[model samples]
Target: MYRIGELAQRHGVNNDTLRFYEKHGLLQPSARQENGYRAYSDADDRRLAFILRAKSVGFSLSEIAELLSIEVDKANRVCSDVKELVDDKLVKVSQKIIELERFRQSLQILSDGCCGGPHSAEHCTILQALESFEENDPR
Candidate 1:
């Protein structure tokens, strides 16, 4: 049996973070002591470790909860559900990479257009491009 502080310390997490996980229904203690202190078991330690691992792999708290729900179901023995979630995240990550590439290209174009001459700011090509881009853009 371990108190909340001891459990958090053993796991290298803050006490409030453990409390937050409890509040989110991701971690629960085995029982409460008479003094209202939380009493955790080895099982709680294992569960918290799982939660941290899931977060490290880019799983949100809600996503971890969903995975946990499926994990608890002894009747359904399938891996497709977890695979689908991971596949969806991959698609989203791919789309974000594409968007970031486009943004980088746009910045490169702007940087290339600048001469950095000792001229007035009003004559800056980058500024002119930005000012006229919105009006000329069809998208």
Candidate 2:
């Protein structure tokens, strides 16, 4: 038997994370020691490691719970569902990457326009460009 702190350290997780996992039903119910402290077995450590690894790969708590539920059964439906979720996440990640690239390009344009020479804020080229946009806005 291991104490809660020991188990958490061994699994590279915090005590609050363990408590949260238990509350979310991702972890099996913990056993209590005679003094009312939580005790864990080696199996619990393994389970927590699985949860942490899944989370590191972008699985949400709810998704991890579902995965755990079907882990023992090896259900085809569950496998397909997880695949779909991963596909959707991939799409969102791709879109975010594109958006970031666009933002970087825009920032580079602004940086190139700005003069590094000492100048008042009112005369700054970057500020001038922003003022030009404000003037052209219909709103």
List the candidates' TM-scores in order: 0.75, 0.72
Best by lDDT: 1
After superposing candidate 2, which stretches have Cα over 4 Å from the reference?
75-78, 125-139
Clashes of each: 0, 0
* Model 1 CA RMSD to the hidden true structure, in angstroms: 3.0
lDDT of 1: 0.88
Overall local distance difference test of candidate 2: 0.82
Candidate 2 residue 90 Cα shift, in angstroms, is: 1.8
List pairs with backbone clashes in candidate 1: none
Evaluate all candidate structures by whole-model CA lDDT and list the values in order: 0.88, 0.82
Q: TM-score of predicted model 1?
A: 0.75
Q: Write the per-residue lDDT of candidate 2 for residues 31-119, one digit (tens) a residue.
A: 89889888887878778888999899878898788777677567546567667777877788789899999989988988998887886
